[model samples]
Target: MTAHSRNTPQFYLTAPSPCPYLKGQFERKVFTHLVGDDAAQLNDLLTHGGFRRSQTIAYRPACETCRACVSVRVRVDAFEWTKAFRRNRALNADLVGLDRDATPNSEQYSLFRAYLDSRHSDGGMADMTVLDYATMVEDSHVRTRLVEYRRRGPDTAVNGRGAGPLYAVALVDHLSDGLSLVYSFYEPEHRDRGLGTHVILDHVQRARALGLPYLYLGYWVEGSAKMDYKRRFRPQEHLGPAGWELKDG
Candidate 1:
């Protein structure tokens, strides 16, 4: 293929599928390949424009009759530090999250399996194998990383790396504007520790430290209880027809 064609992304559409967030509704997605040398820049632009990247593809809901999926991003500087957020951080205080490369291993897959079994057994990725997990972590053309949350090891202070088996993992995309949490999972047995909430808290702090403005959290369906957690992070922006608009409460 010519360089010009490779550089210019081509968009496509998917066949209608049952909407995962809303009942009795169908969902369609408009997507394009996030490949070539300009992948990172393309990803950043698309994400800001309400697209989400999954490996080499960037897509968003294109449902003809539904406009429920709204793209969300947390304002790092103005995020609310409510009592519950502090409580969740204290609950998982003993753990440390070390940013690592976008490589997947057996341990992460094991945790991913347990998480799916406990929470998403009926979900789309319920039957993923180890190799599938690897592809999900490594097939990206744009920037990505894995933040592994683990128990603080003896030498944690010196090396900035955590210790022991992985308690939780977050697949992140490093964008020019901020960090995008592609996906995250934790040890099913440690649900009470609030690993998921802690991870978001950690990311929020990280972005603020880096002087980034927003922490992209993908789409939030207004009526979906499954996505209600995204609402807790205050001072966020929801992508609307005009553009990114601030949301209070």
Candidate 2:
């Protein structure tokens, strides 16, 4: 029998759109729905095959004339922090991350808006309202969580979590094999602290503690400066024609 006959996913291709990662290129995506009781399992399988989830949709690049985008996942067990990464971690020591259920809140919206205004002011999500932010966080059917980062408060030692002003937030998806970093945003003024890199490092540590083998970093498009930092997570695997292969420095 065919995979679809076994209730496996049916894929569909999206219409061409202006590429968000690179200028002067059109992009298309082949996607499948994540729904029903099997959504979690299906999402895991698809993600392993180099797909990324957005709400209930699992998609990957299917551009006709370009192949710049490549899916990347760090091998958690073998990952080692470089000197720069260590410095970034140390610089953000005052920040604490807390993982909570995938629910929307005004605080998250406020930070998200500031992040967009600072970093992605001319990007597509610049005009997103609170309701749009809420949908981005809570519309998913698969297992998801919101990781909040804030300044460490005096009471953190007793509470074991931050209780100060929010600084960053990441929308994460839990898969059987690994954790997918769906999206993340942080305070723009704190750019010098490398809060973005710190968050990914924290997730890598969290995955190791959870016994998960990989931390999916999503697509890394070649020639895109915005995605260049992803390569810093050494001993990472990139999805290619032969499946996941380790990329050498």
Candidate 3:
């Protein structure tokens, strides 16, 4: 069935839970299961409507009193790299990212674990096991890719794949209008390289190369220091009551 077929999507609200991004706040979500033949199309519509996907689920914040979680996307055609962003890209010039089908790897899990331990020890996904990682990457029905970033090695000229340990990895979805960054993590020790920022920059380039208009960056929680980096990608659009509008940083 197509996304507009008679089978209508059913959305549900989650019970109150402690807000992950902001303290002293409770968070709720309106979510639906993305499945069947129309999963990809449904995903596209939901995403454009301000929902985000996790595995086979699409969800968006539906808090009772707070609207802190604002959906953000980078406007690819209008994106211009600032001096700081250019420096971030230059800092990781030795690394290359290889796009692979959404599949789980032990090495990716190892780096994921290290990243969780080092950066988000008390966060929601800190205790995720290898199986969970596998499901996160492989359980999707929509177009998804796991891009692994690594340092250039001896065989770099022969094959495009980078050699040595993994420096960073991003779980991304290819949507009709843009690429959606589902989740990403990098080697904690390499924080100086600003790999997180580089990953977004790379995706912006990828979207531009693909002729996509936007690169979805998921929710940007206002006042959350952890989400401050997202605002750096200027010429972005924030989905609000009036719909997506340009927010020039």
- RMSD (CA, angstroms), candidate 1: 1.6
List model 1 lDDT by residue over 1-249, tens digit each: 645577898889999999988999999999999988999999999999999998899999999999999999999998899999999988888899999899999999999999999999999999999999999999999889999999988999999888889999999999998999999999989878988899999999999998989999999998999999999998999999999999876
Ranking by TM-score: 1, 3, 2
Worst 10 residues of 2 by lDDT: 1-10
lDDT of each: 0.94, 0.91, 0.93
- What TM-score would every model get versus the actual structure? 0.97, 0.95, 0.96
List pairs with backbone clashes in candidate 1. none
Q: How accurate is candidate 3 locally (lDDT)?
A: 0.93
Residue by residue across 139-237, what tens digits does model 3's lDDT show? 998999989999998888788889989999999999999999999999999879998999999999999999999999999999999998889887999
Model 2 Cα lDDT, one tens digit per residue, 71-178? 999999999888998898889899888889999999889889999998999999999999999988998878899899988988888876897788789999988978
The C-alpha stretches of model 2 lying farther than 4 A from their native spots are 1-8
